[model samples]
Target: METNLLFLWGTPRSMSTAFLRMMLERGDHEVFHEPFSSIVVQGRTVVGDHTVTSHDKLLRLLEERARDHRVFVKETTEYDYLSTGGDRIPYAGRHTFIIRNPRSVIPSHYAMNPAMACEEIGYGNQVEMARRVLAATGERPFVLEAEDLLDDAEETVARYCRHVGIPFLPSALSWQPGDQKVWSRTSQWHRDAARSSSFTRSEATYEATVDSDRFLYDCYWHHRPYYHVLRKWARTTVAA
Candidate 1:
């Protein structure tokens, strides 16, 4: 009867990784670690861009690992380019968009992947991405903020549970952002893997940044037509 799946879409620096740990720390045997990661998703089987076998094939593998217990799916990705390549499968599941103020996100993503420009991404545009989703994409994910996930953990988690059709597991509230109980070192892909406050929700809003009023911040990831794709991502991430 455990028929729920969770697909979280957002940029690299958002709290989706923390959210991943939250899902794993639970006692459900059906809920496995990230089945879509680079390791498990490809492994010896070797799945690539246009040649993805199918999520059903992946689900079968998890079911094999879990014996016969019910299995749940969990994955996190950016809003704009998710449907491309083999990521279309996650879009078929119950989904949510984890939004954080891009000010906090730019710094956090820089911390995790320091090769990008720092001025373009922010929470405001993450919201704009969500609105574009209704107009273009075939997906609709509930929107919830990283700040709320931290400040109002209980309510935020309950809302996520409600969206995914899972019973609210109180234990998910205390789930640490990077606990080993939920993941091995290989599972995490963030900078300083053990600890980094750059992803915090406290100062995530535009108000937190000095460039709030600027016409343009950074222009690497948020450029022209593709920029609208980010809005599409936000629309899918926004929770109903």
Candidate 2:
């Protein structure tokens, strides 16, 4: 098990990139943004100074970094990254998750990639990943709803920091607006996030709604149940 390692696994269009950006702002942990997706989408990914070309090598690199730094990795379960052969979920770290309503997730995703496959919506994969994390860790991984995150960013993030055994950094809730190198590969999908200094609601109004697109409608219903399954364990609101 890699000590000082943490993971935030999530579904697509779930505001996870924003979450990672906050982690980057904290300046306390070494962060990786979708290292798995980088490999799957572009054949190779550069982690720090190392060029990681395979899943095994990437895992090894993360393990090495965990020895000296508190490592935070944020990734989505899209593209069947979890389905590739032997136990893919790195069981060494504390795992957490974030999710959004499919009604919102589907439409937002469709706008970015009209050819979006049902699996790319990601709730099903999240459910499976959570189960695997629980089986390995003997506890349900902390879960966050994107709605809650956007509604009360401070409270949600503070709760998450407590759950993961880190100090709540209020200042990390905001950052200077700029493009991050980590988001360059998926720049188009993250422009809004890069431009924001704080957690704000996504303003992308999509023409591809569940009401209008049969594919998106079907995809929503197909993965909606899994969303509920994970939501069952989502972090509860703290009392004022």
Candidate 3:
């Protein structure tokens, strides 16, 4: 059984990929980028170069691999795999989450997938999964706000490492700019991240966004409450 399986779940456009890139730079842990997403979204088993064909098989593969290596997984929670209700998840290791403002998330998501469903706005599913993980594990998943990460990449990641009982590696914050095979399935969504060498927050304009687009406007309100649910628990630089 894999005891070091760490999951980093987040909503779409939440800067979660950038965080995963940092993990890859760490040179430790066997990382999988949205591995379960193939089964849920594409109906395939492709995860980088491997194809396990089913959630059960994929989970087992991860478990088996964890015996000899530390495993880290980063996934967007828009698919509701966690909401389906079952013992499908391996609750043994750590489950952590990251969230971004829906005001920002909705517009960015619309830019990529205009046909995206409200659920794909994702804060709702993200929070629901966190709740389920909490119920199963008896521990609230560590939540990181994108703002905090962008504000201080070094400190935020250091905090995350401590919370998960891992060593803090300042070198992981920046990496070479290139396309990684693990990101092959959804390269377009990660264009900026693919070119970025570090955590640099871009200026996202909302002026002509939600107000001009009715769909995104609704999406923001629909998921804003859920975003706050996770946001309240996220690590911030503010003093308690």
Each model's backbone clash number: 15, 0, 0
Error of 1 at 94 (Å): 1.4
lDDT of 3: 0.80
User: What local lDDT does model 3 show for residue 11?
Assistant: 87
Q: What's model 2's lDDT at 210?
A: 92
For each candidate, what is the lDDT?
A: 0.49, 0.84, 0.80
**Candidate number achieving the greatest lDDT relative to the actual structure:** 2
Estimate, for each residue in 13-123, the C-alpha lDDT of model 1 and write its tens digit.
666766665665665634543444543335423222233244556544544444444345444443222332343443233445776655556545554444544333434
Estimate, for each residue in 54-84, the C-alpha lDDT of model 2 and write its tens digit.
8777877887888888999999888566565
**Candidate 3 clashes between residue pairs 3 or more apart in a chain or in different chains:** none
Candidate number with greatest TM-score: 2
Task: Kindly report which residue stretches of model 1 are placed more than 4 angstroms away from their true locations once superposed.
Answer: 29-72, 78-91, 117-139, 175-216, 220-240
The Cα error of candidate 2 at residue 45, in Å, is 1.5
Give each model a TM-score.
0.59, 0.93, 0.91
